[model samples]
Target: MKDYVIGLYEKAMPNTLTWREKLECARFFKYDFLEMSIDETDEKLKRLDMTKEERKALVDLMFEVGVPIRTMCLSGHRKFPLGSEDKTTRERSLKIMEKAIDLACDLGIRIIQLAGYDVYYENGNEKTREFFLENLKKSVDLASKKGIILAFETMETNFMNTVGKAMEYVKKIDSPYLGVYPDCGNITNASKSLGEDVIFDLKKGHGKIFALHLKETVRGKFREIPFGTGHVDFNEIIKTSYEMGVRRFVTEFWYTGEGDYKEGIKFSKDFIDRKFEEALKDK
Candidate 1:
């Protein structure tokens, strides 16, 4: 049977919770791993006033609770302008990424998701592309030193918005540490294609996929729609991923502040379990 690792994005919580509360929420969800996006201005981290020892103690507590951090989803790109023409902004972004890399290394996490180049702007010319490549090379070099695998995620607006483009970028990088984290929901709006098409393209690019993000989209808006209520074909996606040798799959269900967190986790777990069982019987 395929081993399914269930997780949740830290951003799913309302920013009102303390660090202890966050831990309680993770326990409530009963997740196998915790995926967090650390922000520089996060008040919770500030309120904790945690030293390195304190942080380690907290990590130890999580381990004792049976939910270790499997991935660190760095939010560096939001504050620092990566892949931008602005020199100062670019430098700042790299600095933030460097800090994130160090934190991941110290925390013993292996997977660091990069924001890639911002796609909100339409001026992604050759210069911008080269900048991204150069910065990515630097990031990968650092990750390689720390024995970390850096996974670049595709956004709606970036140099690599599709699986093909993401694969192309990863191939150009030509490093074992550099790969793609395929998001099932992001590419749903590119055309009028079905979710199966997204899975097909991702399968084609599976050689470069290091991790998987399970999300769903409706029409053009991407959200945390419960599995099977949206367009993503979970069964085929999971089966193809398993065949391609992807061992880590992260479920991203953004909390909409309406329902119980336990219910969301159970619903997602049931969907994943059902799909894995189906895939196994078919195999």
Candidate 2:
């Protein structure tokens, strides 16, 4: 039997929870893994500084609860995107990537999802694209050395808003450890921006897709919307992607404590599972 590793993104949990509590939440929700977040908050960012012993203890709890944090979403790039034309910013982001690899090694995480934008805070150009590729090469080199994979996410940017653009860097880097972590919702939004219709075929990136961010997004909206409330064509996207090569998936969403969290988790789990089943049936 084939296994589909469905994980819950860290956004599903309250940031206030201790690592152990977070693991427990994953176990309670029947998820196979937890996609850890290393976002912009000072508290979240501090995880990069975790000591070896602390990391081991956390890993121990992961084993205890049967919820491994197998993937990481590296969101710090919002502050220090690697593709920036500024040398200082690019250097700082490169250092952050190095530290992130070390942290991943300690925690037994396998893949780090890289943000697509080389410089999200600024506009893009050929120079910025060159800088991003250069900096991404450095990151890929480090990740290869550390025995971890770095999958780039297609984001809301002109540079790499689709899997095809992400493939540009993946092909340039051409490392076994470098792959694409596509966000189908973001792809829809990008298609709208370009006045195109699904320019990126997930199958085109087959063998290079490490995983997926299964978030819902309407054409005009991007983040924090309820699941299935957006224009994300879950049935088609899931079917096509599963038929390609992706078996790992993380449902990307933010928890604002507006409604019942447990109920919502169960609902999403069921919905995704149903979609996966439908995808398999179509095969």
TM-score winner: 2
RMSD of each: 3.0, 1.6
* Tens digit of per-residue lDDT, candidate 1, span 1-283: 3365756777667656655666677777666677877654665224223468966876787766766777877655655546667788779767776777777776667798776565234367777677777887887888888888888776666456567777787888899998888776776544334334666577667677778877777666667677788876777777888789887877777777887766776677677767778875766
lDDT, candidate 2, at 83: 82
Pairs of residues clashing in candidate 1: 119-157
Q: Where is model 2 more than 4 Å wrong at Cα? A: 195-200
What TM-score would candidate 2 get against the native? 0.95
How many collisions between residues are there in candidate 2? Answer: 1
For all predicted structures, in order, the TM-scores are: 0.87, 0.95
Per-residue C-alpha lDDT of model 2 across residues 1-283, encoded as one tens digit per residue: 5477889998886767788887888888788999999986777778899888899899899989889999999989888888888889888889889989999998999999998887877887889888888888889999999999999898887778898889888999999999999988898898777776653556668889989999888877878877778887787887777777678999988788778677778888888888778768846
Worst 10 contiguous positions by lDDT, candidate 2: 195-204
lDDT for each candidate structure: 0.70, 0.85
| Model 1 RMSD, rounded to 1 decimal | 3.0
> How far off is residue 96 in model 2, in Å?
0.6
